[model samples]
Target: MDDLRRIDLNLLLALHALLTEKHVTRAALRLHKSQPAVSHSLAQLREHFNDPLLVRKSGKLELTARGNALLQPLSEALGKLNTLLGTAPFDPLQERRRFRLALSDYAARLVLPDLMRYVRVHAPGFDFAISQASRDAMLAQLADGELDLALGIFPELPQDIQVQTLFEEDFICLADKTAVPDQSGLTLAQWLERPHVMVALRPDANDEIERALAAMGLQRRITVALPHWSAAVELLPDTDLVLTIARRAVGPLRAFRQLRQFPPPLQLPKLAYQQAWHIRKDMDPALTWLRQVMADCCTTGMPSG
Candidate 1:
């Protein structure tokens, strides 16, 4: 702690610039200071760290072992500091930014159409790239900076991953009208007797519906397991297979005249669909705006009931 007190915080910036540029003159140009000023800061940095951070090699400067070790941590620290102190308001109209996102196909169908329309009219310069992955993979991607945001039913999360609840969704049963015959709903016995179509990203994965059934010592026959919600719904129109899916996912497929939706026979926990990002992006204005827009789209665009 005493060592930290003796060192100047500004010298860290100079050290970063010097190590990044590897030349005092170039570092000066980056910092907008004269060559001598950067050189003086470099000398002070060497004294504080007790290492010649940069060394001359064949007439060109290169980072030493300690300098190389410091570069990534120093860069990340400085980036966080800049985010902390920088408060310039974001202008979506002028800034061109592409955000990478991960979400299930169900969420993509429920949210993307509305989100795209809103961005096109409001923030034309902003763009999005979408991918889909499992929950654990999504969290790992968020930590590794591979994905900027993820939207799904994130029930459990790491401390460093921030989350915002977009909306609560519940299960609805979909089947061919001829298959069920009853327009009201299925009884628990009838529901269990039917061959079901399970939508899961992983073939072996058990979803909330399966878990809920297991809790009651009951399990249904999943004749077909698929990773896509759209494909699963399409199969329901022709076959006797029943699909229990999120209510929001049913809105877009309402045009399927042969399919009918009914309340699930058993009570299932409401799914809180959320958007998650790394804690490092908490203060990012662009991400903040994007999250809000997503929440708004989920609220106003999707069927609430």
Candidate 2:
């Protein structure tokens, strides 16, 4: 058996390039080194492997039987090394890397438009897929690298994950403009007394709006319950009153040109919408770019209280 520790890293790279391109000039181009440099490395690999890894056949370079057998493992090992060294440059503008984010419809509506605009201008080639998943499932996907980010009001997050506050907003009332004296604000008492539309991804015990209301010795009269925030906006234009979620959910409703915002009558505990991701990716260049871009979009597009 060969002493693996005696192996030359550069020879392994040469072997990989040779197996991939099968031609000296082409492999040199792939390595961004001169043809002579690649040829020299190929000789070193041949001596190390004690076999001609590639041979000329019908005027084209072809791999030997040993080379053919070594290809898969060699490629896999080189790939592991490349990833560890972060050699694969992340080109969001050209690389079709897909990112999945788990967020509620409200958060998506609030943040996605701006996020898309940024991608169009900056990372035009990258794609993002957002899905509404349960908090547990979302966290699991994030931890397992199946999801890139989660945007919502996470009351608690795993210690292995890192959360950054995007924005904090107090609860507000959404109603027809005529319902409120001034469209700018509402009193807590008015919010408690009004008929509200409650929105949630699924039937859950802990509702942030309700919790905020209860802390103030008040509770909103939730006349209707819906699964998504967009549905609530659709209902807002026809009805005189409904509780419109503040921060991210407000702009989408106003775009429909029917609802107005009011300061809640009483002080409701402000909810902090955060962006969470795996701690392992904290220093990754690609992840950093994504985090900054989304965070910028959140701040620039969503109304911060």
- For each of the candidates, the C-alpha root-mean-square deviation to the true structure, in angstroms, is 9.4, 14.1
- 30-135 per-residue lDDT for model 2 (tens digits): 5789999999998888888899999998997778999888877876676676689867677767656678889887787777887887777777877788788877
> Model 1, stretches more than 4 Å misplaced?
1-87, 252-254, 302-305
Against the unseen true structure, what C-alpha lDDT does each candidate score?
A: 0.85, 0.73
Write down the TM-score for model 2.
0.61
Clashing pairs in 1: none
Model 2: clashing residue pairs? Answer: 185-262, 185-263, 186-262, 186-263, 186-264, 187-264, 187-265, 188-264, 188-265, 188-266
| C-alpha lDDT (0 to 100) for residue 267 of candidate 1 | 91
Give the range where candidate 2 is weakest over 10 consecutive residues by summed lDDT: 296-305
Q: Write the per-residue lDDT of candidate 1 for residues 32-51, one digit (tens) a residue.
A: 99998998999989988899
Q: What lDDT is obtained when candidate 2 is compared to the true structure?
A: 0.73
| Model 2 CA lDDT for position 165 | 93
The lDDT, on a scale of 0 to 1, for candidate 1 is 0.85
- Candidate 1 to truth, TM: 0.72
